[model samples]
Target: MASPRALPTPISATSFFQSKPTAHSLNSSSVSKNLSFWRNGSGLLQLITLGSTRSRSNAVENSSPTQFSSESSQISDVPILSCSEATEKLRTTRETYESKQQYLAMYSSIFGGITTDPAAMVIPMDDHMVHRGHGVFDTAAIMDGYLYELDQHLDRFLGSAAMAKIKLPFDRETMRRILIQTVSASKCRKGSLRYWLSAGPGDFQLSPSGCHKASLYAIVIQDLSPSDNKGIKVITSSVQIKPPQFAVMKSVNYLPNALSKMEAEENDSYAAIWLDEDGYIAEGPNMNVAFVTKEKELLMPRFDKILSGCTAKRVLVLAEGLVKEGKLRGTRVGDLTVEEGKKADEMMLIGSGVLVRPVVQWDDQIIGDGKEGPVTQSLLNLILEDMKSGPATVRVPVPY
Candidate 1:
């Protein structure tokens, strides 16, 4: 059976799914070359000659159908989708939003001015941060009209930006004010605020030297549902944790962290835990882990190679009341190994997203008494109280 010659080349999703096709061409000499191929039994039998692959690619874009001779292969009379025809086949409908109601509100500052316009909530495509990942970000949780630890996370955010060498668009005081105001603008009493500092829009260059200044973005994310403290399982993350320098700074480079979490999910676990090179426990992808020892001591990993978790530190402080009440002997920070961590009386993951989560198991082994220990619940209640009515130092009041 003779293979169909000049059978239309099958297009990839990129070109085939486009809204329209702009041009068409067929390579004749390349099809007349030495290599024979079948376009999946269209009765087309043609050989790609000795021309270079690059030449074939170029010729496919340059030659016309009349160039291919009928003596070897027959061109299909099936008409291909032209610009106007493809418009009817491949166009997709897009949804429209008049305004972001209670869900989200974004503020962008290109020349250092913030706006709540839905049409303008975007960064320049050429920003160094967009092109080269030269940016840093931090988030704060909002609860019951209060911004929890806004200053603490902001301090860390500024510290991370400094580490990334990205300058601040406004002074520290101004930045804080802008954050509170953005939350107020959204009128979201209970939600989260995420902000980013980026090396502002510029040419597609590797260095920030060509950029004029840095940019700050703030957005209000409404998550009205309360926290879910349900216990979750975890696995040992095989992904290598970033080195101390980059790990300490909360930059946008989260590929390793994302992979680690994905690995845990793939294994039917909540999130994966990374081990330091020395084989001691480090931290989770986004949260910190703490263990209550058989002796009633709270042991947390040192902040040497992981991001210092604000919620974890505060939990430690609140747990000191537990120490005075004799519920715990004391709290300490040091390197923790897997064996030491898994054999504790109780284990909990603490972070902004999950205030405190009791861990029932690690890998295939049960943790502590295989239940949510009393101490974990006690500390959780204490933290919740603090969030609601703690001293003014911890909770920043939202104007809205």
Candidate 2:
């Protein structure tokens, strides 16, 4: 078995939950609707499945909403709007594009500037990414008017582009600025943002030389509702993640992850956890896994077989502080067997979008009485508190 990373001290359950800030006053209903639309209809999920048959037909025959007044003003030249103005603009846009058809058209207009009918958007008959899966992408959450960890995400995005041998035209700083501008243009404060860089329209051939320049697009989406934060049940699937040389890349090739998630859903689970060939826990479809032992040690898989998640890194840092205080034992990331995870006192999954979600059950086995474990809840509280408190560094204002 591969040795685990050097362990850090453990954290106490009390301090973890005690530090979290109270929830913000955002509208829960609106957030839910927006999340559903973005996650189910937009390119986020489509990139994984490679196509969305159901949404394509609805996208057709819909006119793009006249949001933003077709103003050709550049972001660098335009003045940034106040929070109130941004919020009002977004509300007006949502009201105008209430129908699914209009929303699809609006998505294309605002994100990609592609005016094709919605039906044409999902007609997977084209080879683009669906047929050959030649693309790379990254997603980051916009919280409290700031894009969280965008620089880190961009680094990972560039790595994925290199892995796929895709020539991304935009430099990191330029792309970051564009992402912030896109968010400001959408007037979304607390939501998600996805940046997809795909090999330009290509033929059915597998070679990258046939593809033209890469295409970049971004979309701002609403945040997850509190209801989704209640915690979720998970199922361990027989499907295992194969260790490819490109395992670290978050490329468009996600069939394994998709299939694993589908299997979990079929078994009535919210997410799927896959094991590696050696029967060691790998990770969830889109999140990193973490567990707390009875001795209060934080455990996770080493980065060798899983994506180095930004949220996971932050959590580890928080855990380190707890260890320093001698509240818990330590943090460990290595090959954790299925039996070890099942036997853990607490378990949770972390992601940029979800933050931290407790796992009540793994497969049929109840993990720590099959409810939100005390330690898991504590860690989540700590993370929430950290997010609510602004970062120490001064935030660079987003250019309109």
Candidate 3:
């Protein structure tokens, strides 16, 4: 190997770093030579030179073995590209090599832009929602070119945004039209539609006052795994539920809910259900809990301290027919005890993603003869029927 100059000494904040890493100036010849050296295998050379500039989180990976040992003159081997040169290099490389996996249409209100190009679904780093959890979001299912309960979900989405103190970028009707337009642009028939109301991008600060305005974004997702109506098991969650004010807001602050779900999966259950501080059955991480009493009454926990679930509310409404038919004597909401829930004739979880799911077991105890009970399945069929051929009051057809 050819010999090279000694490496530049490490620069501390008070030392040559106060100026630049290359405090030692080079002649035109040396600069040309350095630039040439950086053209190939220069990633390693810049590692030491730019170490102080990059924070610890900028983790770079180099799977291939290094060509030279530490004894090599890294400073001499590294090239120093001018601003223009670096920009051109990066732009060319990014154009040729950097690409994202394909996605359906996405709409962003920041620039009032909607595009199918996955590359265009970008957000600024300074968004308060990105840094300070100052945003709210909601999703509605798309089936056979119909938007399922979009109005209800949007109502909740707006409600959450209000609770988060994030104002809508547009009026309610305009927002609804935009949502439908976004979904229609995606041209997806069987998938999901997820959208967000963000405290718009601005200075990275604790308060969102600096934000220009709130923004809305929407995207389409393909949910191939339709609800199978299979029975699943759940356990009482140990994670603490959020206070009523924050809990009802469906904001992006979901760490606790996520942990609760993980806790259930870790324990070999389908989902985790939380309990109030007083030990009343609260709700699941992302769903609601309901039960068919031995006396044939359908009961659910009050929405006072939880996110008022859209799907749960719809189930309650749809279950009214069962009430008139004498299948369910009545349907109502109240504080439910865990002990009462474990002894119910049937239990089911309700959510938009899962229309209705039978709960056969809770912890180690069997729920109602250890089988998916009749009422649970009946309600599941009802929800499914509403989805496929429900009245226009519940389904919104996509223009595409």
Candidate 4:
């Protein structure tokens, strides 16, 4: 009646399915009991055993064979895979799937090198960033072999890390060099670069004091999708927005943002906009929201209670051109009520990902004439132009 130990050797899937005597062979009476359990509820029991192997799991080691029912035996049939077998399985699983974006290169401070293989791009499970969400991240767009606003995004990334109380693994200059080198290695002309700063690997605890050292991780993603300029609809989110302190930092915690986005999709909209605790328009789930009032003044919600988006800041600079040209009266950032936003002549979402996407509808209200406004179209064109041939300060060249 003793519990069986984990298998030392890995077994093939074919041999696993074939009837053979296991290390701890069950007696005829035990087999009869198992067969009876299968007859009673075979489908669910088989599903429970489908991918199980006799692994060295703590629960399996602590289990008492004498106390187990037939169902427990079904769960115990998992094979204990060797390291090589596990690696092979991971490779096979990766190969079986297709993704829209291709990961071109990755740099991990833990391993102290870069890897181009997607299968090898993995982080430690014990990293505080992975388990405890003690991490901060930022992104910069890659266009024509140049990184757009790399310094700006890195500045924000470091600020977030400071707010999270995470120590820097390297100086800002060194981290910037590594990111540029990673993008250069990728040989991707047009894509995006995302990186993270974490509290590093440590024991699974709520606090990060046990972490060994801080960590830096970066990846270059190859994105080839054509830009879409079509207007989209958005709905007001019911999800609670994060507090001002956490909201200002670019942390890895995005549960509410994701839920709000899903809620928008359920309502057949593009994105969800969040209202602050004071019933004023805050921002979108992952982007900044902006409106053009009837007086042609560009207005955006203040960043005091929301993320200060890099793209949104640049848009403010670009909006100055419209004002000089008399296309816009002025630009302002302050609290915007839902009624004010809905009554605006034009609305748009701005972020590194979206880049000046016009909003045609907000809830049941049609923005302006429920069409992409001329000013919105012009702003998108201006951003596109800036990305292609912006000033040296905004564009950092990658020596690929």
Candidate 5:
């Protein structure tokens, strides 16, 4: 893996303040004070009353209705509500506010003062991994208010950290507690959680010994909607994956993966499939690639260059049934040519985001009938069923 780059700058959530204040009294000192406080704080006071009717009535009478309407109009532009929909608008606003507050509370509870932003939490740069890209991360889906495969994901994360010589700040059980607390606090029962660790900030040198501390963080993101599962096109990239010395470890250094993804995006494809230095098939930028032969064998590239994907492992387990029934055969990683993939009976990319989406096209060549093939469809169904039931114990479930 390449050395880690400077962490990306954090993104803010200030767009929520686009709404203007609604029509309310500001003539009296109390009303003015409330308005001022709202402007500085949450601006809730602007939508509510805080004083006696006499004061409010006096402020309303003295205030221009036109001005109130104009202010209300500006606030109405928020797209959340209109003056005619004040009651509903207020309710929605409160709900949104409460949700954000809950998310923050959860983050604080998990990592203490280490972080608070639920979007782009940061670990200091002095950590060894920050300077050397010596840590790992794992993410899993949350559905119906329950975290999915929390334990399995954490196990992978810890293993990667150890591979890079970074120590975990907490044990598996402790980390699980923090993850649950963070997820619950965020009120993100229906989202994805990204749990990552970094060799805590250290000197600017590449040596791992300089890094004494490690940082762990979890981010809860909105879940993928069904609409997002639509199949995507992919293109083969000229870039080759540098075979990892520790192919099974998931590390922070991902420039090669990022570059491959950028190539796919630039070409308007869903993903980029890479080749190895030997001109054999490797994998997608962030997923495992699989193809079904004319003989109905399920073949995957050996773990030579890409990280071993948890989703890919699950799919392999599910394929065992088919293999035993003589419906399919399982083949391990080996050199596979691009021609083989293009001419296969079926092909699909599996990962956390893409799942088991069939490859409708590879570049301009149509894959199979240029639609989802039987093997791809069946595998997708089996994986979905497994996920819905619960984590597959044969497969690891990282608890958080």
Candidate 6:
């Protein structure tokens, strides 16, 4: 019989890492640094070895091959973490990085409660909304401890959910209370509240037939950046617009809109304007497009083929005041052509995010002397004033 093969010597985790040959040690330096950093006096257990100490020697030998057997073998040192380890890693990772947008609070139906910790403000990986894009969402701004257009945005939110066939997790009143309570928990005075309705957590699949139930999630974002109403440029989008059926709902399927926005940025423009199938002016990626005609008439595209903007509708109502004051001849919502829009006296993009942003140029054509128009300025001022001290119908106080 052949002599018994010599068993490899058992090695501790630290020694195993140090003994790796330089030629095969592609990530040895990073692994050593990570080990050093994590092995500090935290009293945490060292990396666990699989099987018995003697049998694991073979595992170590197999893991660190003489040479990389495949591209994936180059990553052999990755740790298999437990659930608690993963959670701790997530917390530390979040603590180590800086984010532009600060999330103050989050409410999730999955846990049936609110959380102030950003690390805990996570959705389930298997949630249909997370994996499959089967969700609808809406937002309302918080001004002076009050939610602006809460009911208006909430109505739109429910409407979008209904259109998407996602049932409500709770009644509208309960959701409203939950949202207010979430903002209250955050103690955020000047920010925005965004919420979503989805088919809930389930296995990863194209259909929601396997979902357990519907879900609702809300988040309060702290926004301290001052608003800038300066004029911006836009380009005609090369990306095709979504069909009217999908465009009319505020669903989470915004790939086309995102691509159009990216195309605009690639061309040194602020937004890309989409045209309807019939080639009429549709809207911006996330905002509605409006124009001031040569006759001083405020014109916008009909909402039948695009997302019905809350801010745009409010602006339309507020424009009536401008009309009464002779600032505008009148306000009209209908199909508008590119020639009609570009040749107009002024153009503006209206949405909750942008409020009333002036458009200085469309493609190469300058809009109305290439400056922010008086109408756009007045509109932005009107919106700001409304948010600060609007009627009870528009602003809902958060009883924190």
The candidate that wins on lDDT is: 4
Regions of model 2 farther than 4 Å from truth: 1-127, 223-226, 392-400
TM-scores for the candidates: 0.78, 0.68, 0.77, 0.84, 0.66, 0.83
Model 3 bad stretches (over 4 Å): 1-102
Which is the winner by TM-score between candidate 3 and candidate 4?
A: 4
Off by over 4 Å in 5: 1-120, 125-131, 224-226, 323-333, 391-400
Q: All models: lDDT?
A: 0.79, 0.65, 0.78, 0.86, 0.67, 0.86
- Report the number of backbone clashes for model 1: 11
* Model 5 per-residue lDDT tens digits across residues 92-124: 565665342233322321235323343324345
Ranking by TM-score: 4, 6, 1, 3, 2, 5
In Å, residue 174's CA in model 6 sits off its true spot by: 0.8
| Candidate 3 C-alpha lDDT tens digits along 325-348 | 889999989998999999999998
Per-residue accuracy of model 1 over 320-340 as CA lDDT, tens digit each? 999999999999999989999
Instruction: Rank candidates by lDDT, best first.
Output: 4, 6, 1, 3, 5, 2
Candidate 5 at residue 374, lDDT?
Answer: 79
Question: Where does candidate 3 have its weakest 10-residue lDDT segment?
Answer: 56-65
Deviation in Å, model 4, residue 312 alpha carbon: 0.3
Candidate 2 clash figure, as a count = 8
State the displacement of the C-alpha of residue 296, model 4, in Å, after optimal TM-score superposition: 0.2
Comparing 1 with 3 on TM-score, the higher-scoring candidate is 1
RMSD of 6: 10.2
- Candidate 2 CA-lDDT value: 0.65
| Per-residue error (Å), model 2, residue 173 | 1.2
Q: Model 2: per-residue lDDT, tens digit, 1-400?
A: 1111221221222232233211221112232212121232223321112114536323321323332223212212343344345446656665665452121211221134432232222222233555777777788766677777777788889988887877776787877777777677666667677777777554567775665556676666664445366667898876768474556788877888889889988988888987777788888988999998878899998887778887898888888777886766999878889998998888899988668899988887888877887667677777777766646431334443
77-129, model 4: which lDDT tens digit per residue? 76657555666777799888887788999999987888887766788778999
- Candidate 2 residue 371 C-alpha distance from true site, Å: 2.7
Model 6 error, position 117 (Å):
0.3
